[model samples]
Target: MTGDLVTGLRSALSIRFVNTGTGPCTDMVFTVGLPPGIVLLGGTDRVVLPVLAAGRTHVHELTLQARTPGPFDLVCTNFSYRDENHEPVRVTGWRAGLSVRAAPVVAPVPQPTGRLGVICETPNLVLGAWDELRILVINDAGIPLEDVMMAVTGPFSGAVPRSRISVLGPGMMARFTFQVNVAEAGRHVPLTARTTYTSGGAVTRTQVDHLTVAAQPPVPPSPPPSSVPQSILYLAANPRDLPPLRSDEEMRRVKERLQLARNRDRYRIEPALAVRFDDISQSLVDHQPAVVHFSGHGDRDGNLGIEDNDGRCTKVTPEGLAALFSLHSRTLRCVILNACYSERLAWQLAPHVGHVVGMRSAIGDPAAIEFSVGFYLGLFDGHPVPDAFARGRAHLLSRPGLAPEHQTPVLFPPGPSW
Candidate 1:
C-alpha cells in the first residue's frame, strides 16, 4: 500500500478488502474514486470481484500518474456484494483511504555514492585579514561526470568563490581558489564546501567538506605589560531598601578559582562594592584597573541598576555607561557586565573598549557564578580575553542539567589582544 510518487511518472498502489463473514460472497463490485490531479493509467476505476470465500481477502492494485504537483486522496466510493442469503448490499462514503503526493518540479538530488573526493589547502590564517585557499575535487569513481559545480564557503567579508566544469573524465580532477578571512581570533572556525554533478543521467551531490580556519599568533599590545599581576575592579550594586543578592558569593568563587589557577600570582583583585555613580568614576580614576566587572540587575531597555546617594535602586542608561568608559578608555582594557539584558549595552561600549562581555538574556544564579569563576580562571592562567570568554561559556555547558539560557553571554569586537 506504500509507494513513491514522482512527477510525470507512474506509481503503483495496492489495497486489500477482507470478507470476515461466515458465508461466501458473490457478484461483488469494487470502485475507487480517484481525486483530481491524478489519472488512471488504464482509464478505468472499477474492478469486479467474481467470488470471495469466508475468512478470505481480495487485493485491488492499479497504476496512477500525476498531472500536477500536489496531494490527492483515494477513496472507496462504491461496494456492492451479495450476502449469504443472496441479498444485495451497498456501501458508500468511505473517504481518504490513501494519499498520493507528486514530487516537486525540482526534486532533491541524490547523495553521491562515494564517487567524489575533496582536498583543501590553506595557509596559516590571521585574524581580520585575508588568505588564499585551494580546493581540489577528484573523480574517484572511474567514470565521467558532467555539469560539475563546486563552491567554497567561509567567514569571509563577502560572498565566497565558486567554480564549474563541463566534463570530468575518469581519473580527472579540478581545482578552485578562494580568498577566505576570519574576523575573530579563536582556536577554530568552520569552513564548508559543496559539489553537485551529473553521473549516468542522475544528479548527485557530494557531502560538504567541514574544515577549520586557524588563527595566527596574536598581535602584541603596545608596550605589553610584564608578567606582573594585573588589577581587576569588581563592582556590585543593590538597593539597601530592596532584596539582597548572592553577589558576595559570586565574587568569592571567582577569587577561589583564581587562586587555584596555574599562574595565580598574575592578578590583583580589587573590590568597589555597593556601587554608586560617583564610586564607578572615582574607582576608575584612582585604581585605573586593567579590567572592570559589574554584577547587578539590568532592565530590558539596556540600563544597569546602580545604587543612588540613598542606596536606592537607580537605573543607568547605556549612553551614560558608554560615556564613563570613554573617559577612561585608555587604561581600561576590558569590561564585563554580569547582568541581565546587558548585550545592548555591550554593543554600545564595544567601540570605546578593547573587549566587552555581556549577557544576551536573563541568567540563573548558578550559571552567573560559574561563568565568572571560569573567566577569571582563564585570565589567571594567562589566557587572552577571547579564550577566557570561551572558557567561561564552556564551564556553564559542562555543568549537568544546565538550561540553555545559561550560555547567554556573548563577546563582542573579537580578536583583541586584551
Candidate 2:
C-alpha cells in the first residue's frame, strides 16, 4: 500500500502473487477483504488471472479510501488455483496493517462586522450520503442580541426550515445542526447561513462555506457466506393512547414471505412485541441483529412513538435514536423505520448506519404491509438494499389502491450502487 493514509483521503493497495513451483498455475483468484472504517474508492476487490508460469509474478492494485480514523488490517481472504496436477489448492494468512489519521480542521475566518462571528463546519461528503453541517454563531460584541434567528440556504438544508435562539449573551456561542444530502460528486457545493438579530436595531449578516463532494465509494465486497443465520430484530409498538396499528399482521406477512424465500435458512427473525422506550436498548444488546425493523407511529416533528411505563404513547427524538444506533454501527447493516413521517430520522441515522429505509409521508396499513413483504423477498433473493427498496416500491405500485402511496417509502442516500 502507498500514498498518504488519512481519513477522507485516497490511498492505494498493492498485492503481489508469485509462483515458485516447477509448473504453471491456472485459474488463479485473489480476493481482498477490507475491515470496518475502510472503503474501496473504485475497482473490484476480486482479481483473477488466467495463467502464471513458473518464476512469474503478478501484481494487483486497488484504490482505497478511509472513513474512520484508526488502525485497520487488509487481508487476502481467499487465494486459490489449479496446479499442473489439476488439483485445486487454497492459500490464505496474508495480512497488512494500516494507520489512518484524522483530517485536519480549517479555522473559520472572522467576520468583518466584528460584532457577531459566524463559522460553518463542513464535512467531507461522499456522493449520495447524508451528513450533518454545523454552524456556530458567536456573540463577540459587548452587547447582547435578542430574537436571534438563523436560516440556511444552499444545497444543504435542515429538516425544519430555520433555527432560532431567544437571546445570545456576550461572549457566548450557539451551535446549529442541519442535515445535508449530497446529490452531486466531484464538485464544490456552497452553503450560506443568514443570521438576523435585534440589538439597538435590527441587523442581518450572512456567511458562506463550500463543501467538496467526493465520488461515491465502491460497495465493499460481500463476506463469504456463513453458516450462522443473519438475525433480524423486529420491534412493534402500539401504545394505548395512539391509534391502533396492524403490527401482528405485518409480522406475520414478513415471516410468511421469508419462509417462502430461497435463502430462508440464512435469516432468523426475532420479534419484540409491545416495545417500550427501555426495551429498545435491551433488545439490541441481547439480539445483536444485523438489521432492525421498527413498526409504530411517528409524529410530524420526526419523533418515533414507543410505549411508556404506563402503556401510553412516548416519543423518541431523532437525535437520541441516532446516538443509540451509532454505538452499534459496526455490526448494524440496515434499519427500517416503517412509520409515518420517519424520513427525518432516516437522515439522522444515515451517517451511523449503512442503509436506512423510512416513510416520507403518512402511509396506509395495506401499503406498508405490501412494501415490507416485497422488501424482505428482495433481500432473500440476494439483492442489495437499494434494489430491495425499489422492489418494495414496485410492490406498492402493482397492488390495487396502493399505487398512490408507492412514493411514500424512501431510501436515504438513494443510489442503485448501494
Candidate 3:
C-alpha cells in the first residue's frame, strides 16, 4: 500500500506559517478537486495528512480521522510575514506525501480468489550480492486483484523476509521483487510467505508459502581491461532507522509503528528521502555518476542536512564538497539537489559539477522527491534537462500543497565545457 497523498491547488490555502522564532519560513498549502467519479470513498473512513515543516513543523499535526471518499478540491499557499522594511523573508518547508492520496487503504488493485498462484518473474539461483534481486510478479487468478500483499519468511528467527506487493490483476501482473539472501548457503531453503488481498474493494484474503534461494556459482574473476570506458553506477541509499536520540525503551511504541507502517522493500516517502540523503558524494565518487541527487533538509546557503550511520546529522560545506569531487577522474554530466533551499546549492556547485540543476526557492519533501524522480525517469524516457524540468514542474505543481504557479527547481544550465 502506498503511503503518500499528492494533489494540485495553486489558487488557495494562503496561510503564512508564523514561526515567531525562526530565521525564515517555508509555508506551502494546496487543494485538489476530484474528477468525474473515481474518488477514494470507502472502508475504514479516516483522514491522512501529509505536512512538512522544520523545528516547528509538527505544529499542524492535528488529527482529522473521519475520512469520506469523494472528489476533493485542495488549496495550498505559503504565508510569509512581511518585515518592518516590508522585505520578503524566506524559510524552508518539508511538504512531502501531500501529493500522495492520503488514504491508500482503498482497494486500488483488482480482487482474487481460490488457490491463486502468483508467478514471480524474479531470477532464481543468482549470485549473492549486497543488493536484493528484482522479481516480476504476475497475478494468474481469473479475478481482478485488490489490496494484494505478500511476504518471504522462514522457520528460524532469522529467515523472516516479509514485504507487500502493489496493484496486480488478471493478465495485469506487476514486476514485484524481494530479497532474503541466506547468509549461510544451503539447499531446498524455505521462504515462508503470507498474503492479504482485498476482494474487489471489499473483503481481505490471504496466502502462504515456503520458497527457496538456490546457492550461487563460484565468484567470477575480473573481466579483461579493454580500451573501453567504464559504465555508470546508480546508488540509492536508505537510512531508515535514524539512530534514536532516546533509548529503545522510550521509543518501543514509536518504533513498532515505524516498522509496521513501512513496506521496507519499496521506496518510501518519509520526513526525508533517506535513499538519496544517505549517500550524496558517493554519487559522484563511486559511480562517477553522470547525474547525482541530494534529497533532504537544507538552508538558503546550500547547507545540506544528512544523518550518518550513527544518525548524527552534518551539513555538507559547499566549498569542501566541490573539492571532494574535484579529485575524481569521473567528470559529472549533471548534479541535482532535491532538498529545501537547493537553489543555493545549485549555484554553489555549478562550478564543480559539469551541469547543475536545483530549485531557486525551498521545496517540500514530497514535491522535491517527486520532481527528481520525474526528471530521472524522463531522462530514461529521453527528455533533456530543460524539457525534463518542465515535465517535473508539471508533476510538482499538481501536488496538493503546491501552488500551480509555484517557482520550483531553479536550474543552472550546462557549463561551456559541455
Candidate 4:
C-alpha cells in the first residue's frame, strides 16, 4: 500500500464504513470530493467494487492517488435487485470520512530575480546602540515582486509599520535605509524577518541576519567647518591586477595548498574581496582616511609611480597625492603603503596622513600579503593597528633574512587624533 503511494511518503490511510450491506446487487458506487485546497492527488470514487450475490458479504477495495492535502468525505452506494416486483431498491447509508495529508510534490524554491538579499551589515551589536544600514534587494528573477511585506525583529525590534519595499523588477535593484538603534552595544543581535510574498497565492519565509554593534566611544564633532572643502582618494592601481598566486589556476592551487598547510581563518586572514579602485565612491574619496594602502610601486626620487596598462599611474606622484587630498575627505589619519617606495614619497606629504607604511626597500608580493593579513586581523579583530603592524613586521623580520632590504613601515606623525 505504501509502495502504491510512491516512495518515501506516509501513504497509509483508513476510512471505515459502518455498513457494507449484503445484497443481490448489480454494482456499487463511491462518490467523493476534496475538502479544500487544490487536490495534489486522491479521488473519492476510485475503488473497484466486486459483483455481489444475494447473500455474499465482500469487501470493496480502493487504491487511491491523492492529488493534494485536505479533508474529504466518501459516499458509497449499494444498488441491488428488487423483490420480484418492479424496481431496483437502493441499499441506503454507506459513507465514510477521511483526512489525507498527501504531500504535494515540493517544487524548488525559485531564485529571487528581484532579489532583496537580506544581509546584516553589522555582525555584532550592543543594546541601545544604533546601526546604520542600507538594505540591498535586487530583482534578478524573471518576475517582478510587489507589495512585499515583512516582519523584522531584533535590531529593528519595534511595532513599526510593514515597510513597503517598492517593486523590484528583473535585474533591477531597490534599497531601503533603516537604522537599528540599540539600548546596549557589543552583543550579537539577530535580525530575523519573515517575508510574505503574494505570487498569485502566497509564500512565506523567515531568514536570519546576525549583527554586532559594539558600544562606540563618544567623540567630539569637528570644530565647525574650515569653510573650505578637503578631499582625498584611494587609488587602487589594480585595473587588471590579480591577487596573490598569479593565474586563476595558480591561485586555486595555492589556496588549496595553504588550506592544507594551515587554517587561514584560524590565523584570522582579513580577506577583503578585491574590487576595482575606480569603483570606489566619490564620498569615500571626499573623506580622507587615517591610513591608505597603495598596492603597487612608487619611487620618490624619480617623482614617478607606476600605473596600470591603461596609463592611470598605479604609482602616484606627490602632486597626484596632493591632488588626492583635494577631494573633500581630508581627515586622513595614517597611510599603509602596501607598495614599494611609497614611504619615501610620503616624506613630502607627511602632514597629509599620519603613520606612513612603505618599503624602506623594494617589497615583493609575499611580504605585501603577509602585512595585509596581519594588519587587518589586528584592526577588524579588535587589536590596535600599531600592535598588529609590530606583529606582522616581526614575522617577516624573524624569517632570518630575505628581500631587497629590511621591509619596514615608515611612521609619519599624526596631525591631531591618534
Candidate with best lDDT: 2
lDDT of each: 0.78, 0.80, 0.47, 0.46
lDDT digits (tens) for residues 50-102 of candidate 3: 33333343222221222333334332233333343435544344232223233
The sequence of per-residue lDDT tens digits that candidate 2 reaches over residues 165-212 is: 888888787776666665655535655567777664445544343333
TM-score versus the correct structure, for each prediction: 0.47, 0.51, 0.34, 0.32
Residue range 51-143, candidate 1, lDDT tens digits: 889999877777888777655677777889898778899888766545455565676544434557675534246777676666667787667
Instruction: Flag regions of model 3 displaced more than 4 Å.
Output: 1-283, 404-406, 414-418
Q: What is the C-alpha RMSD of each candidate to the true structure, in Å?
A: 15.9, 31.6, 33.5, 20.4
In model 2, residue pairs whose N, Cα or C atoms come closer than 3 Å (at least 3 residues apart or on different chains), thus clashing, are none
Kindly report which residue stretches of model 1 are placed more than 4 angstroms away from their true locations once superposed.
Answer: 1-221, 414-418
Candidate 3 overall lDDT versus native: 0.47
Cand. 2 TM to true fold: 0.51
Which has the higher TM-score value, candidate number 1 or candidate number 2?
A: 2
* Model 2 weakest 10-residue run by lDDT: 206-215
Worst 10 residues of 3 by lDDT: 263-272
TM-score for candidate 1: 0.47
User: In candidate 4, what are the lDDT values of residues 14-65, reduced to their tens digit?
Assistant: 4332224444444444444323432323334444343445555544334455
Q: How many times do residue backbones clash in model 2?
A: 0
